[model samples]
Target: MRECLELAPDAIEVDQASVVQRLGSSRTNCENGLFQESFTAAQGFLAATARPRCVVQTVDLATFAGLYDGEGSNDRDTPLEVILERSEALALFVLTLGQTITDTIRRLFSEHDYLVAALLDGMASLVAESLVESLETRFGRHIAECDGKSTTPAVLAYSPGYCGWHVSGQRALFSVLKPNEIGVSLGAGCMMRPLKSVSGVLVAGEPEIHDFDPGYSCCSGCDTLECRARIARVTGPVCAKREVAWICSDG
Candidate 1:
């Protein structure tokens, strides 16, 4: 893992729509009132404050098993196990906007500016997601360069605590990759220290899996109200209107 590794990405473009979605607003709703003010402020805060960083380690799937299984499993089937079944190699990464972002959030909360805090939170998440997307882009190009195939490679990224994988298993990720190098640490609760950080594995060349979009903004599989907004935008039917009614009714 140490012999062949890529340092965390430096910086990435912030996706405003995704940030607004994370703030619980749709593309249309993001255009007005507090949502617009918060969105603009969030963009400014990100422009001045966000410090995007990421680290990627390329290893054989077998090495991944040795690291993950050796640490421990959550009783539920580990996603690494599934990836190992199909792939010979995988990319593991830990990414975070520096601690300053979290510090800003704490200060915002102390100042009772909850709206801005929430907006900053969304901005941080979007930056992390963008980092992951950057990794996918680079990995696909790397694979294509090595294989020289006309078709682009397919890669899947999965994180802990989602898709039935237990959050406790995140310890194994920290074990193999030195999150400390990128200014991240693991808490006792299996959470990343910077709070806005994300860690996950990227699996490539698995024939069993069909979809290979390495990023997600909104979907039914997600629990965010933005999923309903996405559905309504595309299909003209509001499947989860009640789910997001509170946002409209909020004081």
Candidate 2:
């Protein structure tokens, strides 16, 4: 599983526009030369320092509840239950951009280069997204082959912190994923280390459940007011500063 889940750093593509928007400006308003320069530097750093890794395993949907160890109630609308209703199996996964990216951001914060650092923070998010995209593609192909289908099946990755699922559900996630196999570990607070890492389940049986189009913004489902995933609406210079602070504050 570990051998098949190693994600090469080059596999993830950093979205400069998304990172720039997170910095509080669009391409037109932001200085062309400065944005390009900073973006180039950040992209280079991400490509060079990011060590993308992942682990994936298939589990029977019937036993999905056992993975939680009787943690949550038998509520029909619970995230796991919702997933099980749509699929016969689940692909539990853990993915990360590795410690190098986190360490680089820490160093940048120490040096007071918050602008570039925050941009890197946003870029790291994209890198993780790209990793998941790649994983989903591969998962779809493999599942199709197993079922003797002409087209790949769909795969949707959902994390504990999103949807109605409380972030504490990560305890259950780690119980099944063993994230450390991919160089990821849960912090004392249940947040994954490396800051940019992500984990969750991928339901594989239904197209409507897992067939999300590429480029569907995760931001649409996220409402965290200060999330780095939130695109800046030209709020103000202070808003951008708050984003930087949020990233540095063990985000």
Candidate 3:
């Protein structure tokens, strides 16, 4: 049975304003009356500055194994009906999570404290990122294919805030990519259903990527746009990273 990727649990922590007591000084540009306006502006900037994509790879599998003796799933298949069912099921799950998280934000923070709330939510996103590592560790951490078919090697899996990727500018990044496929939808204010979700590409390259290889595969195996595939090789490396972001869908 193939094992599915899972993230580290300790990664699931939030950074509320109190979280900043040590990290740095807090800034509140989002004051009353202006809170909504400030938020809207930030959201707009995030959307515009967000790199259409950061990473250059993607992944798809028919089956995955659980971490524990029995957790998520084991065998895998990609029948058309099964794919649709899985997509809908997972999308619904995302939507349900989005709704629950949105409700929490509304109840927890003041209108002006939205930014702080986003930080805290990003902390929660760390859990999802574990999969990036888990996949890398369990499978082949880097590029394994030699002929032409394999997963991409994630050099950096950056999200908002890490490299200037902020939460506000990502309003429309996650709109309809797969709303029906994964129950992801944008609220009137542009918040994704699962307020804790994020968006960012995984920077990757082939095993031979060294020196200044601009022509190198920046996207690994995300699309047919990367290095050639390995010959007759089926096994591949794992890919994982934290999907944390209070609402980090900038790009």
Candidate 4:
């Protein structure tokens, strides 16, 4: 949505369709019904705002994002193996996310349950934040493609709550990201719904200054091609919307 130069070289590969479908299905058939349509309106929001200032810029954050391991999802005092073995913790982990998202994709289509719809939409906005990171990777790739100079791929996604960043940092991140740059906006309830979802920045350069920790690399490592249209996306191809529009327009 941001009208700058072309994108940079993208790195991470994940099934965007699978993730969205999974999010939608998990929201619908799972314990709670969640509604996720941020991706659908991301472009529309950009179209509405039409300002290039909100687009996010690419930056190397190995130092900023992966600076400390003590701030990870793992407890500082606990060991990795112990944390993995704690079923209670794992259940809470899944359930917390589940509660955060009511029933995904259903309310977006039907709009019958207002409260559930709100919760689902809210969670979708949060998950949609990843799109911002993915775009950053592609933007990085675009920089390389257009510039014709080789560049390193993104090391990892650096969001708040990882390393020493408190989740509260979302405030600053939302503000600094400024959706208008890329055609997105944040809601009064801190929800970047519709299109202005928020994510953090991490550049690829000077590994000596910062590099992702091996222990938590899995979270950032993206070798899998999961997005439905990875190649086109990197080439600045936005995902097709016929099916998503059908879902939204259906009675």
Candidate number of the best TM-score: 2
The digit string of per-residue lDDT tens for model 2 on 1-251 reads: 22335545555566666777766776786567766777777788888888776677877765555764336622234444544677745688887888999999899889998767877888988767656656666666668888788965545566676644567778887876677766788888788886888888766655554322222233355555332222121122332211100011111
Q: Cα lDDT of model 2 overall?
A: 0.64
Which pairs of residues collide in candidate 2?
none
TM-scores across all candidates?
0.73, 0.77, 0.33, 0.37
**RMSD in Å for all candidates:** 10.4, 9.9, 15.7, 13.4
lDDT of 3 by residue, 120-219 (tens): 3333343234333333322233344532446544343233222222333233234213343334555554455455444432333343321122232233
* Model 3: residues with Cα > 4 Å off, grouped in runs: 1-97, 110-122, 125-154, 158-179, 187-191, 206-251
lDDT of 4: 0.34
Q: In what order do the candidates fall by lDDT, top score first?
A: 2, 1, 4, 3
**In model 4, which regions exceed 4 Å deviation?**
1-54, 58-130, 145-152, 162-164, 180-196, 206-251
Local lDDT at 90 for model 4: 9
As a TM-score, model 1 comes out at 0.73
List model 4 lDDT by residue over 55-157, tens digit each. 4443233322332232344334322222222211100000011211222435444755543444334434543444444444554455557657685333223
Identify the runs in model 1 with alpha carbons over 4 angstroms from their true place: 1-11, 26-30, 78-80, 206-251
For model 4, give the RMSD to the true fold.
13.4
By TM-score, the candidates rank as 2, 1, 4, 3
Error of 4 at 16 (Å): 10
